[model samples]
Structure formats: C-alpha cells, structure tokens
Target: MEFGLSEDQVMLQETIRRFVADEASLDTIRAIADQESGAQNVLDEKIAALGLDGLLVPEPEGGSGLGVLDAILVQECFGYGLVPSRFLANTVAAYAFGASGSELAGNIASGAAKFGLVLNDVVSRRDSSGIQVSGTSVTGKSLMAINVRDATHLLFYSDDAIHCGAPDETSVVKTIDRTREFFEVAVAGADPDAKTADVEQVFAVASVLIASDTLGAAQAMLDKAVVYASEREQFGRVIGSFQAVKHLCAEMAAKLEPCRALLWHAAHAIDENDDEAITMAYLAKAHMSDVATFIARTSTEVHGGMGFTDLVGLHYWFKRIGVNRQLFGTPMVLRERAARQQGLVA
Candidate 1:
C-alpha cells in the first residue's frame, strides 16, 4: 500500500492549514486564552463553514463521510497552528453516537453541540445503573480536561457504565490552559450509548489528537528556539552556531520524529481497522507523551529564561504540550499497557 497522502488528502490538509494560519493568530490565541468563555466562536464558525466539524461522520448523517486518515490530516494542521478548539472530543462523540446509531451525530457535527470525554478512574462500577448510565459527584476534578467550558455534552467511562452528561463549569476547577479548560463533571445517571473498546478507542483518538497538538507545538517551539539562538549571541558568538546549541536542536528533532512516526502508524492502523491498531495507539501515546515533555523542556532551556515569559510566545506551546502529555493516558500508564501487550511485563 502507498504510504503517501492522496491528492484529496493533500488538498484537505492544505485547506485546514490555510484556515488555521489565517484565522488563529498569536493574538487570537492569547485573547481566547484570557477570555472567560474560552470559546473561539469566530474560528469555530470558520471551521464549520469548511465542513470540518462533519468530516468524520457518515455522509448520510451530514458528515463528510471521511475516514480517520482524513481526520488525522486535518487535525494535524490544527496542531501545527495551535488552533484551539474541542475538535477531538467532538470526533469521539460523533463516533460513539454514530456507532450506537443515535441522533447525537447531527448535534455533534454542527458545532452547536460540543462533547468532552473522561478517561480517568474517577467513577466506580457499582455506581452504574446500565450500559449507558452511571452516577458520580458534580465536583470530580479531572486533570487536563479538554473543552469543558463550552461543551454541551460529555462522554464518560467508568468501571460500571459509559455515560453522558451536560457541562457544569460551576463544578470545574481552575486550569492552566484556560482556552481548553475542563470541569469537575458528575455522571448524574445519564446513559452514554456505547461501550468502551478494549484499547479505549475514543480516548485513543483523543490521545492521538493531543499528540498531534504536541508535535505541532514542539515544531513551533523548535522554530522559535532556533531563531532565538541565531539572533541572541553569547560570549561573542551566535549560540546557534555552537556545537551545544546545534546538538540541542538536533535532539529535539530526533525526539519529535519518533513521536510523529508512532502517531502515523497508530492512525494508519486505526483507519485500516487492523487488529494491531489498539496496541499501536497505546504505544504511540506512550512515545509521544515522553517526547512532547522533552521537547517542551529543551525548548525552554534553549531559550533560557525568556522562554517562560509570555512575551516570547514559547510558554503557550510549552504549557499546551505539558498538559497534553498528561491527558487521557499518562506516559507511564500507556507504556505499561504497551509493555503488557508486548509480553514484556516483569
């Protein structure tokens, strides 16, 4: 099989990239980050107009009827631009609702409806009433939850039931990335309409999108660091020309490539509906988590103290990567899963 983007895929990728570059500037990102709503409604509208919100749903359901491969390409561009939204969560909701043959698909694809997923071990099984129903507190704090502020609905999985509920920001805790905040949501006995796949498929897709976000942010950090190194001289020489700085940049790229390839393999496997996709998704999440953290740290170090300053624009990507690294599945948890599957358990 050819391992290259088809003409349509290339066009779609370009379309996404252009829209992001045009609509999501640094000023816009900062504005949204500081906004109370944290909802980029203007940008969201543009994305919807482009038909991206419906990309993953079946054509009959008013979706693009595209596959995972298409979603990955478009999402990767979203990452490259640091364009913040709840695109991944909506995709998960669409898939879950579609798989369950529910009417939620139309709600999700139109952008009028938003969804968030909970993968943490917060709710217990005994609390569940049925397959699509469960119970929980209204104040359960989840780390690095996405799109909580604007989510109209949430998909939650626990030991007992996979469930859904509405957003309750009053119960949400404060977050670092205000633009992508999550709330302390309760199950409230709502039914989710689907079962959790063995590999945590919906969460897996979220992980991949977060990985793509990290990859793009890392690339941005790397670019910013290189420019800073070249311009900011130390000891009467451009730091970028020094062996140490060169190696640092090189290592950043090296760490990034493995994460990129791992995600590519995982996404490809899922699109093809291969048995190994589950295992590979875990591996990809595990690899990208570590790599993303490393890139964030290295970028900060390369930029010295300036990286931490808001004026430098590096901290935004750094914080996003830091948060993404721990979301859905932590690197440790994913690695354990991958290791066990590989029979490398101790």
Candidate 2:
C-alpha cells in the first residue's frame, strides 16, 4: 500500500523544518554539545513557543488533542535537530497519565514538571515509588536515558514499585558528556500510591518516538553523504563519478524510503486503533534502527577521514543513532518480537 503525508502533515513538516533551520542549526547544536550543559529545558521552551506541547495531550488536559501522528512529526523534527530535551519523555508520560486518569496529565501538558520515562530492561517490570533518583542527568552515564539529569518526575518501572532519590553528581557516572552523568538509581520501599499502570503503553510510544528520531538522523547522514560525494574530488573527478559511490548512495535511499513508509504505517495504525499497530510499530522500529546505524557509518565512509572529526558533525548523528538503537529496546529485540508475531522461529 502506498503511504503519503496529508497536506496538513506536509505543512507540519515544513514548519518544523523551518524552525530547526532557524533555531537549531548545526552551529547551535554544536555549541550546546560542546558546553556539556543541559539545553533540553531551553529547547523545550522554544518548542512550546511553537505550540507543539499541546499536540499529544487531550483537550481536558489543556492541549490541542491532536494524535500520535502529530507527535511523530515533532519526534522527526527533534531528531533532525538533535535537541536533547525531555519532550519525548514528557509526551509519553503525559499520554500515559491521561490513559491512567491521573492528575499529572495537566502538569505534563503545561510542561511544569519534566517527565522522563525509564524503559530499560532493569526497570521495565518495576513500579513507581517515592524514592529519590540520584545519578547522571544528560550524558552517556545514563546510557540512552533521556533528560534524566533535569527531570523533575521520572516514570520508572521495575519488578515492583519503589522510590529513588533525585539525581545528582555523586549518583551518576560520567561519560561522553561530562556535565551529563548516567546515574545508577537505587529504589526503596514500595509506594502503591506512587505507582501507575501505564508503563507498557508509555513505553510503546517511547520506542516509536526513538525510531522516528533515528529516521531523521539517518536522513541527515544520507543528505550529507550525497552532497559530499557530488562535491569532493578524487584523483581528478568527483567521487560521485564512481560507480561504487553511486551504488552506496542507492543503497542508502533504498533503506531510508521503506523505513519512512513503515513508520507512517505504524503511526497511523496506532492512531486509528488497529490491531496491526503493534506489529507494524515493532517492525518499523527494528528496520529503522539498522538503517540509521548504517547511514551514519556509511556517511563517514563517503566523507573519508574528514567525517570523523567534530567539524563534520557526522559523529554526532552516528553516536546519537547508536544510543537511540539501544533505548526502549534494541533492534535485535524488536526484530525478534516482530518475527515471533509472524510465527517465524529462530
């Protein structure tokens, strides 16, 4: 089946593209990454200024009450710009709370308390509690955890409900970005009142969002590679003159287009409440995870050694895709789920 974006969807994509071009340019993102400071809050306000925060929440929750497709659009743009904010976390949590009939929905819709959804295997079966979460906030020490350092409320899951202290320097471990530490949060006594039953549902959205982000990052890498191939000289002619380069570019596009179609198919299925949504969502994520990683790596190949340096910005997307792949669930895990659904045995 052919999938295409509606006129409204096209407009949304364009608006977001313009915003990223104007506000979160390569220079801007580089500056933020360089400082090791959290720019998610600042960027979140900018996105709020665009009125995107209300897209996923219900009308009763002070939002525009659109749907997941809108959220997918925002997710795509966020990936394109590499804005490391709690937007994804907040969106999923707000939706989960709305699903659970919790008062937190309103706060989430208004961006009052930042919500970071934790979907790691270590905590997937756990329940929420009042304990403090002391650890890393933004960097790799948290290993794919989003905006953990700046989060005010964390939607945590585990074998049972437990409390974790608020994150701080001592609790988190330092990694790629020093200012952003990944903390190993410890949980304490159960608090039934603090737990919510919406963890699985929220995780579904988180996985989908991460997949969408990877899609954007992959597109960026492909675009860069194509441009470099056409402009860079080898021996006496452009590298684009080589059949090998042409074939690689073709392979990149081949991987990207199908992933895009699968993504929209999954997003639409979920929005329309179709039974096929889950299967499609997992398939899309798994496929995109591989494609995003390949695009990043191959783009570096197309650009030669120049791509490895920070000046090229190729590594940023490469690293981001690597981290994104592991979040919610790895590509291998999603593929296994999809395969099982298809009744394919290993």
Candidate 3:
C-alpha cells in the first residue's frame, strides 16, 4: 500500500538529478545550443555511458528492460535540466520497436542508431501535411517531426500501420523552446515494412512521458521562484516575506505536486496494462498541461521583470512547458479523447 517511489526509484532519480546538475547546468546547455553540430552526439555519448539509451529496450536487446515508470523518472530529470537531447523520442521509439519485435530496437538499445518520431498524424492529421505510403515508397511531409536531428531512422504512421523509414530530407523548425529540436521531414522511398504494435498503447506511453517532462519542468520553475523570492529584496525586505510572493510559490507547489502522483499512477497503469491505462494517460496529460501552464506563468510573475531576462533563465523551463502542451495533443484535445474513452462523448 505504499503510494510512493520505491527506494531504488528514489536513488535512480537522485542519480540523474545529480548528473543534470553537474553536466547540464544552464551554462552547459547554452553552450551546446550554440553549437552547430555534434551537440547531440556529445549528449548521446554521455547518456550511453550512463546506460540510459536503452532504458526501455528489452534485456535481450541489451536494455535493462525497465517499465514506463522508470523511463518517466529519467525524463523528469531531463526536463528539469532542460537538457537538449532526444531522450524523449528515442525512449518512445525503443518501446514501440521493442513491442513489435523490430530488429531496429537492438540498434537503438546499443546506441548504434537513433530513432526520430513523426507520430503527430496519429493525434491530429493536417490536410496539408502527412506521410503518404505507396508500395515501397513513402512520400509527403510531416510538419513537426521530433528528434529528427542526427536520427538514423524515423517511425511514422502511414496506410493504417506504423512504418519505420530512414529520413529523406529534413529541415529544422524554429520554436520558442530551444532546448529541444523539431524538424520538418520529407519522406521519400524509404522502408515500407509496417511494424506491429498497439498504436493506442504507444500513444498512451508518449502522453505519459510528455506529462512527466512537464511535471519536472514545473517543479524546477517553482524551486527557482522560491529561491529568487528568498534572495530578491523590495523596500528593504526580501520578497519571500511578502504574502503575495509566498502565495504564488505555494500555489505553484500545490498544483505541481499532485501532477507527479497523477503521472506516476498513469505510468504504472501502462506497466500493469490496466483496463484504464489509455484513459488515465489522456487524463494525466490533460491535467498536467493545464497545471504546468499555470505554474509556469505564476513562477515567472514571482520573479518579476527579471524572469523574462536571459540572466534569470526562467524562460527555458517556461518555453519547455509551452512546447510540451502542444506536443502529441493539447489539453482540450486530450480531454475530449479521455471523454470518448470513458463513453462520455458520442
């Protein structure tokens, strides 16, 4: 009946937390962001050294074969650091490929290949953009393909099946969040084999991971706001002494704390293959999106004008939360999906 992280889970979280603190500090992330190439390569090396590249892959595939919850913990740490890496996309890809018994899963687990994700069409397809599969050729465009930089393979949905293909031509898409990269990929005559995995299960796993990322980012913002309030002074008194600032920080903590538990439960549901796993994933994503947005805004307000400045660097977490809200599905879209799953909508 223990409703919390196990001792090993706590240790795992702390290990990644320390690594982020030492290796992916704000300055370090800024330096990597400014680089033109080899940035992700460096990160991949570090992650592989930590044996994190294969966190979700099966043991037979050289991975630890951990569950979704363990992956969630690692992703939360990445979010807190705002580390610009493809851990999110790669983890999901590993799960998908592993579930389907794809050979590429071993490459991913062994760090021999990187997998990018182009499943936006699965959530909400745009008439103007999508991957078209014809025979052995895949053609068309995906406006928002994630982790495409330096990816050796792309997982996308086409012709009512999940297809893995090598990216043909890709262009970076600029966004407010610089911590992660987005690309517009043009698929042309790539691999045509459709891997067999539960599409709904993959989507659910992706949603929970995204929600966990936001949870970590929100927690970072709240911690930063608290630290800033305790140090910054107004009218010869620290802002932390003010009831307004205290309430802002308190509200952020209160709102963000529950999200962690919600995400944990949702992730556990995925591992257990519970009947409500899909519904819980949708609900967790929707709730975290809304609450994290509130915490991002309130945390920024607590820092005043400095929050918007580069010196404070609060915008990194803020922008991360913003981008996460739109990824996969927005709160409104996810809420409707949850309703549909629960038979509350026609």
**Model 3 alpha-carbon drift over 4 Å, by segment:** 36-39, 190-194
Give the TM-score comparing model 3 with the true structure, all chains together. Answer: 0.95
Tens-place lDDT digits, model 3, residues 61-102: 888898899999999998888876677777888888876677
Per-residue lDDT tens digits of candidate 2, residues 1-346? 5568888888988998888878887776776776634454566578778766556778887877777777887788878777665667777766666655556676677767566555564322224322333332122222234567656676655443322223433254444532223444432222344455544345566678879988988888899999999999999999989999999888999989888777887888877877667667777888889888888888889999999997887877888788778666777887776676567856
Q: Model 2: residues >4 Å from true position, as ranges?
A: 36-41, 122-144, 160-170, 173-183, 186-199, 339-346
**Model 1 Cα lDDT, one tens digit per residue, 1-346:** 6566779989988877888888888888887778735348787767667767777777777777777667777777777677876777787677666656566787776666777766554211223221233233433433334566556777766454445666554355566655565655554445434444433566566666767777777778888888999998889999999899999999988878767667777888877778777678777867876887888899899999888888887777877777777676678877776676567896
* Runs in model 1 lying further than 4 Å from the true structure: 36-39, 122-144, 168-170, 192-199, 235-237, 342-346
Which stretch of 10 consecutive residues in model 2 shows the poorest summed lDDT? 134-143
The TM-scores of all predictions, comma-separated, are 0.86, 0.84, 0.95
For candidate 3, the per-residue lDDT at 67 reads: 87
Ranking by TM-score: 3, 1, 2
